[model samples]
Target: MPAVLAHAFAPHSHDSATKTDAALESSRHGLRALVISFAALMATAALQAVIVARSGSVALLGDTLHNLADALTALPLGVAFWLGRRAATRRFTYGYGRAEDLAGIVIVALIAASAALAGYQAVKRLIDPAEVRLLGLVAAAGVVGFAGNELVARYRIRVGRRIGSAALVADGLHARTDGLTSLAVVLSAAGAALGLPLADPIIGLLITIAICLVLKDAARQICHRLMDAVDPALVETAERILAGVPGVENVGAVRLRWIGHALRAEVEIAVRHDATLLQAHAVAVAAEHRLIHELPHLRAATVHADPDGPPGADHHAILSAHR
Candidate 1:
């Protein structure tokens, strides 16, 4: 049996007080981005809702509702980010970073609800068709909606990627779909003006279906995060970093997971069997240092040093199966 020495380090080598302050600052930045995007989408939805009321265009109404739903996603995400700033309690030693994943689930549900509501409204209008009025104003409103959603989408996606917030990125993609739905409204307005009155409801149905597709995608991403699935490329990056460290004979299991917008990893490395405990520990520390420097979005890491040998059943055991 190989002697395995394992150590876990909190975000960086900073003191507890410094780590707390840093986490708080990160949450603040995420909150700021969420707030700004929320405001922009709300304004856009409000403007579109006014036109929906006056023109009674089912397509525009569907688009407006989706925009509003997308905007509301900011609330859960903002709360999650705020919660992420809180210090770890005895009950939750890993802190509140997992809140972001839970919030993502809420966002997915909101998206599904918006799609269902829109689909119902569109189907109702199709059964009892309403005469759409103010064709020109409705078209202009569609243009405004498109412009606003596109702007918000760009901002949200840019900031979300910058901060590695998957929920924010999903929300941004949601806005992008809203922008396309707005375009569908524009086409419907043109069709209505051409004496095809049923076009509005038809386009509304299309928008509803489009939203459902986006919901599928968003749910997939959020579910993946909740399940702790990480990109293979990231694993490869970790392995390469570990291999480069001096005194490291080989890299073993490299596990990674997202904790909110940040990443935490568990790395297993092998050192020479003859190496002293102190030397092996030094190598683990060096590997951790390199990983923190090289890995993007890394928040914390746990390194386990194992002696290089044929194999150890204890080491090869599944994580849950092990004691």
Candidate 2:
């Protein structure tokens, strides 16, 4: 008998109620991170806006716009986290976890739009050069922007990685880039102080370029998540764990994927051909238990136990025609 253990009914493991509570806790952590970071960024942007108005620094203006956009990005991610708490339905059997991926898409779009707007503003300023006033205030504002963004970046990245959220990690990287570009605003202020009027717009253009680079990276990460790509190291770890399980002759195909921040696995293992149905079922349940306990963020796994038939015996030959 082929013993197949499904995720929902995997015995001797975390129950469905426990899984639901864990998921809700994870979502709450994500939402808390977003809210705090959003507040920090908004305050930073508001301060930079005041400085931009007084100093007329195009570089500072570009940096402020990026900060504002970064703050606004929290909205979609917060929505994604909230939606992820919903139970899986028949129509959407996988649940609302993919909403995080969609939020990542929206984040990428927002980044692209910010880059375009910043580039356009810089080019316009270059064509019509103007004096950047209050150089001291502009430099001070740049420093403040860097401090705020760096703090938020560290917090977001820490929580994101802990929760296995690709979107949150990407957003943290975005914030880090914004921090580096904020320093460029200080350089523009220095250039203006040295009597070079064109430095402000030139630095603005450079900031735009930096934003584009960040956009490329964030887009790549989000696209990879959307494509169901996981780390090769994780696959290796799973294989190793399954191979170490008792009563398994060999480990065969092992597939893994991310549904939201959680991981799901499908595994095939071989058992003794003479094993009774109860024995095969025990092995399958054991395999599932080992996987859920060992893997990080692994919500569930399905283990299919196959009989270790004699060497020339084909167990799946009947399905060969379909393939």
Candidate 3:
């Protein structure tokens, strides 16, 4: 690292301590909301499952399973959020923010597993039909669960955005799945009452398939996060801004990555090496300053200097002839 660039890291790395404190404070409120949401989901899950068992409604049972899974998933999300806010130690210099991503991976896996199991049972039931009873009760319970989940989802979403917590977003997604499955359960219950008992198991299987597809998508997102995949848009924007810097020749390579909550970029540029050391340093500092001002996400930038020989000198050929 150039001497000028060496000090470049100081500005943002210092603020990391402040961000850690802010994260800790924000997570406390988020955790409280999460706990309440978990309790509500668990109660709804048990009530829906009992109603399904009594009514012999396969659709309702599957919907209840979704709620139960959502409830279980919240605990880990809460834990991950709390852990993410903790201060970085020697073992974890980046803190634990990645915990949310890990929790999301686990949640998607669990939901997919449950969906596969439900689908298998639904397929077996389709092979040999069974009489369903009290279809109205099953439908009513499903509606109740849907309403409850929607309420919880709304609050969770608010907290998530307020605190910038990805785990909170995952929890909201879980609640949304419950509400959607409940609607399907309501439809399947109605169909069963109208002498289309096969629709109950069929709808159950479809809901399961839908959840599995969602989990597959979630898995892809988690993989991208873990890989630290650079967002193309951000990289393109940085390239544009870096290229526009005064006194800069062809901008060579640009790399953007996360240093903490804030995004950081390492930029390379070719400049006249013959320029006074102070002049090159000033130009580099200007470039770095402009990038951060233009894009708040950019945490740091570095410029590499190259000697600017006299024009038309064929500097490369002169070295070649000497060899």
| Number of the top-ranking candidate, with lDDT as the measure | 2
Per-residue alpha-carbon lDDT of candidate 3 for residues 209-322, written as tens digits (9 for 90 to 100):
767766776677667767776669888887788689887766767777643234556677655756666666666677777776686534345454444556765535757967
Per-candidate Cα lDDT values, in order, are 0.85, 0.90, 0.73
Worst 10 residues of 3 by lDDT: 7-16
Lowest summed lDDT window (length 10), candidate 1: 6-15
Candidate 2 per-residue C-alpha lDDT over 141-243 given as tens digits, one digit per residue, 9 for 90 to 100: 9999999999999999999989888788889988999999999999999999999999999999999999999999988988888899999999999999989
Residue 252 miss distance in model 1 (angstroms): 0.7
Residue-pair clashes per prediction, in order, are: 0, 0, 3
Clashing pairs in 3: 273-306, 273-307, 273-308
Q: Give the TM-score of candidate 1.
A: 0.91
Scored by lDDT, model 2 comes in at 0.90
Q: In terms of TM-score, how similar is model 2 to the real structure? A: 0.95
Model 2 segments more than 4 A misplaced: 1-15
**Per-residue error (Å), model 2, residue 102:** 0.5
After superposition, the stretches of candidate 1 with alpha carbons farther than 4 Å from their true spots are 1-22, 310-323
